[model samples]
Target: MKPKKKSLSDLGGIMYSTDPSFVYEEENEIPEQALPNQQQDLRVMLDKKNRGGKAVTLVTGFRGSDEALEKLGKMLKTKCGVGGAAKDGEVMIQGDFRDKVVDLLQKEGFKVKKSGG
Candidate 1:
């Protein structure tokens, strides 16, 4: 199934250019590189605000590409033996595993800190 175009901006912002010589230039974005594990300052916290009171362990402060983020998330999930998601530069584990997550990250060479209750 084809996806729907949400706005005029999706058409490259020059939908009605009359000039025959006009050419659409697509913007190329470069993904940010992942930092070394030792340089990563990650925070592990327990969050329960929007999940119907079910607490989740959220790891934030990752500065890396989505692929790297997903890989890290997968590793965390596998090691923690829990189901969760990794996206938007954050990794969410299904339950309250802040202490465990912090220890895991620290062992992996990341500077991890436990934040929040």
Candidate 2:
């Protein structure tokens, strides 16, 4: 069997800079906030692979803060009467609720569309 690939985080402090004068100092620049993708069209897809044949409604194209994502996720879960999580700029609701989710997103002034077969 092939060995699994190591992610960047897996390296864990093993990185080294080759430059002799490379002074590693954390930047003091202010971080820019993520703007919500309210005007962007979002895609709602039903994914089953790698999930033991169970379906999940994946709402993608979200660009905003984690708080916003969680808020939206909570609202969707409540509306659908199901459980789910929001992370990495995506909202995942348990079960296949593509149509319902799309409708709800549209009603919330989001440009959402049901995607995938």
Candidate 3:
């Protein structure tokens, strides 16, 4: 499926260049490689600001691919038996499981730090 264009800039600025020699170079972005578990620095914290006062354990500072992040999120959710989301390089596990999350991440070989209140 084609993605919806949000603005004129999304369509590329130079739509029709009169010069025959003009060549439009498309931007190619390379996805970052996932770091090894031992090399990863992760932070686990408790957040309750935006969720109607219900706390969530937030895991951040993950320098890896989205798939890896999702996998880690799934593992945490399964172990904690809670529902959450993994996106934008962050994992949100329902409830304040900061201590458990830290232990799990540490077991996975990630250098984890407990931050925030």
Q: Between the candidate structures 2 and 3, which one is better when assessed by lDDT?
A: 3
Better of 1 and 3 by TM-score: 3
Candidate 3 regions exceeding 4 Å error are 1-26
lDDT to native, each model: 0.87, 0.81, 0.87
Residue 20 miss distance in model 1 (angstroms): 17
Q: Give TM-scores for every candidate, taking all chains together and pairing residue i with residue i.
A: 0.74, 0.72, 0.76
RMSD in angstroms, all models? 6.1, 7.2, 6.3
Worst 10 residues of 3 by lDDT: 1-10
Instruction: Determine which window of 10 residues in candidate 2 has minimal summed lDDT.
Output: 1-10
TM-score of 2: 0.72
lDDT of 1 by residue, 16-90 (tens): 788999888866756566789999999999999989999899999898877888999999999999999998788
Error of 2 at 101 (Å): 0.4
lDDT of 2 by residue, 1-117 (tens): 112337855444547889998776643645436554567568999999899999999998776667788998999999999999998768999999999999999888888888888
Q: Quick one: best TM-score, which candidate?
A: 3
